[model samples]
Target: MVDPSPESVELARFSLWRSKLDCAFGWFEDAERTIESLLSPQAQNQPETLPFMIFIEPHLPRMEGLELLHLLRSHPSTQALPVVMFATSYDETDAARSRAAGASDYIVKPVDAREFMQVVSDTVARWLPVGSKKAD
Candidate 1:
């Protein structure tokens, strides 16, 4: 997750936990750190250690989510990774930009806690293997 908001990270963590999905979540405050970690020697040596998906907020402190998405797409190591761009409200322009930048999906975060949790769980499940318990 590349959101600086602690609440958002906690919410996503809780949602995944409630759904009984076993995923190692890494929360980064900015795109630079995330990029560094993802491009590190360890991660490059063992690609399986990379995340199954990435959740990013459109507006971040440093680099914008769309910019980060472009960077990820430009890199060979992260080109195929699934990146989901999200925001507090629906914006057609942002959604279109995300899609153009190669984001796997785009979502407008739900206000209701339950709905948010459901959305997060469902999104993650979509990226998991069909028969995996994580997807169930």
Candidate 2:
């Protein structure tokens, strides 16, 4: 996950924990760290065969999620990876742009824990491998 808000990350982490999913996570508030994480498998503790399903907010620093998604698509290491756009508001233009840029999905940031959990459940169901600790 990548967002410019530590509080948001913390809340998401807490929500995941409360839902009883046993997953490891790494988060970033900046583009550089996110890029580094994508480039280095060891940094993320991920096997080389599995690509990351990135959850990134649309409104981020020097490189917004849309631009970053394009970059990732172009880069050999991250090409074919799944990128999910997350934003506070739903803009058709942004959604279209994300689709054009090869985003796997676009999600509007939820205002409450329940909504966020629902999003997580949907995301895991669609993108994660089977047998993942599903949300109740």
Candidate 3:
């Protein structure tokens, strides 16, 4: 998770706990750290270093989400990594921009907890195959 909001991180963790998805994650409120982690040399070769899924918020602390996504896609190490953009905005234009840059999906933050959980469940089930260990 690459969101600056502690609530988002906590909510994600809580959702994971509630769902019992059996996955591990790292959260970076700062985009710079997220980029560093993704571009690290060991990320490609080390199973523990790679992420099963990456969730990014569109409005980051420094760079915008789309810029970061573009950087990730251009990098050889993270080009194929599955990335999901979860944003508060309901604008279709932003969603379209994210999709055009090779994002796996763009989801708006739900107002209801149940709806968010359902979305999370669907995202995990749809993106990560039953037996996958290094995709998200």
Cα displacement (Å) at residue 3, model 1: 0.4
**The best candidate in terms of lDDT:** 1
- Give the TM-score of each candidate: 0.92, 0.81, 0.87
lDDT tens digits, residue span 1-136, model 3: 8999887777777777677677775799978998777776666566557776788899998798999999889977678878999997677888999999999999987978777777776787687756753333
- Model 1 misplaced regions, further than 4 Å: 134-136
lDDT of 1 by residue, 1-136 (tens): 9998888888999998999987777899898898888877777888887887899999988799898899888877889989999787889999998998899999988988889989999999898766665445
Position 7, candidate 1: lDDT: 84
- Candidate lDDT values, in order: 0.87, 0.76, 0.81
Report how far residue 27 has shifted in candidate 3, in Å: 0.6
Ordered list by lDDT, greatest first: 1, 3, 2
lDDT of 2 by residue, 63-84 (tens): 8888788877887667777788
Model 2: what TM-score?
Answer: 0.81
Q: Number of clashes in model 1?
A: 0
True-vs-predicted CA distance for residue 124, candidate 3, Å? 1.4
Identify the candidate with maximal TM-score.
Answer: 1
Q: Is candidate 1 or candidate 3 better by TM-score?
A: 1
